[model samples]
Target: MATRCLRYGSLAFLVAQDTALVLLMRYSRSHATGEMYLASTAVCCMEVLKLCVCVGMLYAGEARGSISGLVNVFRREFLEKPSEVLRLAVPSFLYLLQNNLLYFALSNLRATPYKVTYNLKILTSALFSVTMLGQKLSKRKWLSLIALFVGVTVVQSDNHKSDSDAPHPETGLGYQTLGFLAVVAAAFTSGFCGVYQQKILQAGKTNMWVRNAQMGLTSVCLGVVSTIVKDRQAIQERGFFQGYTRLVWTVIIIQAVGGLNVAFILKYADNILKGFAAAFSTVASCVLEMAIMHFRPTATFLLGGALINVAAYCYNTPGRKDGNKLPR
Candidate 1:
């Protein structure tokens, strides 16, 4: 009973966290008046925070509150076995790239469109899972993937507007093209990064917290490099935290903690349930977009959302022999 409760609770938190993060990011990016916060810097800070949290978790779990023991374990895992840390470098960099893309997508697109479009990652992730992990999918999985692809394409149809159709307030800045492109790239990266990370996690019985710390450490280094490379001049003129507000901090905190929660979900819960949680989050974001962002969803967008939801159900559900249904 306790295990079932934990599973359901984590699933619920994931759905809520995901929905809130999407809505908050869209609101922060589209409605801001003053100097906008740098997305790269925000991503960098999130990585640092994740690393700190993971290290703390590792210390608590492995070191038993002993500072010396913590140092020794950290040294053995990170410093002594350098190769293990290097193995995570690819996924870490890809994750950082995907995050920056999400910020870009949310900045230029409304919450609803971005949320629907980002579902393409499901298709992409499945492809990689089959290829890299040698996982076999049933006919429903393949069909669902195709349906998801079509659904995302249909969603992107809303992105392109005729001159007759006036641009929405969220996209008045005229960067919708770039926004859609960034998210498409993000979807690809998400697919590969997820499979690669899963492969690593299954490779050994290494402490999950230690592995997270390694990825976070590598990600922090890459994030800092990216920040300096792209935003060096901006940082020089304005401070690192310039344009940051309470809302900005809220978004960062959500992103940082949301990643950790996902790891927990994967550890304790089923992926099919996780997919349903994602679908629910997408639905919640659609409703919230209408309420908070004043978004007007077209018939096409609603149709796309339905297709995507069905596709998520198909893709994540096991074959007929394995009986598991979505929660009531």
Candidate 2:
């Protein structure tokens, strides 16, 4: 029913994002700053809109301490902690900045290599947890990290071999290289942001809806500021509005829905586990990229991706259960 629809809807959304990102990469030669800004603006607008809707649903008729039975337990509790509510804002702002940089990188690069490099976020987050938050990891985590590195290397090698043969006139290897580096940096920053967010959640007990509303507002504000600074008159011009038809607007809205799916996943799970799930979008993107280019996936690439997925799963899983711990 609703769960099934959402599940399939999320899968389809990933496929569409992969397709749109690939198209954006292909159009990098003719990419205008205003167009990029507008597309991202659309995403930000929908994010906030949906967040508002979710929050409204939670608070429709409930009075203080009425126990209206919302889906998330944390939202009700969060209403009581005004200080903690304000504290969550910084991490939300950080996520906005990180995602904007990530979109810029995706706009410049192809799918496969970008995804492989993005896996480093797990390592970055784990290290940050250890150094910044004083969190300890089990030995199994160390092994999982090693496995993740090896798998990513293999995937990157395979991607290189495949992309080497593709013809490129305007956007060349240099742009792609820079994009890869940018995405890697974005991934690292995003990982740290997630760590901070988890801290806020553990401290404040904010529900998914409340946290999403805060984060969405932060992103919308950030996106508007960035759009203004980059192009002051860009918002006034009708070109940004009319550049695409209704179909394009629909696509952007769908991407916003995908973003909500991601936000929901992040709310309840460990950030590292959520990062691993985010890799599914990368795989979907790679598949679409290969299909659009008429290049069937090579055995090496598929196998490498599978191995990477396995490592991501292992690294993301909890190290210990109630009675027993996973092997190191």
TM-score winner: 1
> Which ten contiguous residues of candidate 1 have the minimum total lDDT?
162-171
Cα TM-score of candidate 1: 0.91
lDDT of 1: 0.80
Candidate 2, 16-134: lDDT as tens digits: 56446444443432343233334455546565666666567456533333444553334544556556556756775666666566655655555566776787887887787678667
Model 1: colliding residue pairs? none
Q: In lDDT terms, which candidate is top?
A: 1
Task: Extract clashing residue pairs from model 2.
Answer: none
The CA lDDT of each predicted structure is: 0.80, 0.60
| lDDT for each residue of candidate 1 in 104-199, tens digit (9 for 90 to 100) | 887777777777887877777767877987777777778888998898888888743322233335335437777789888998897787677766
User: Mind sharing the TM-score for model 2?
Assistant: 0.70
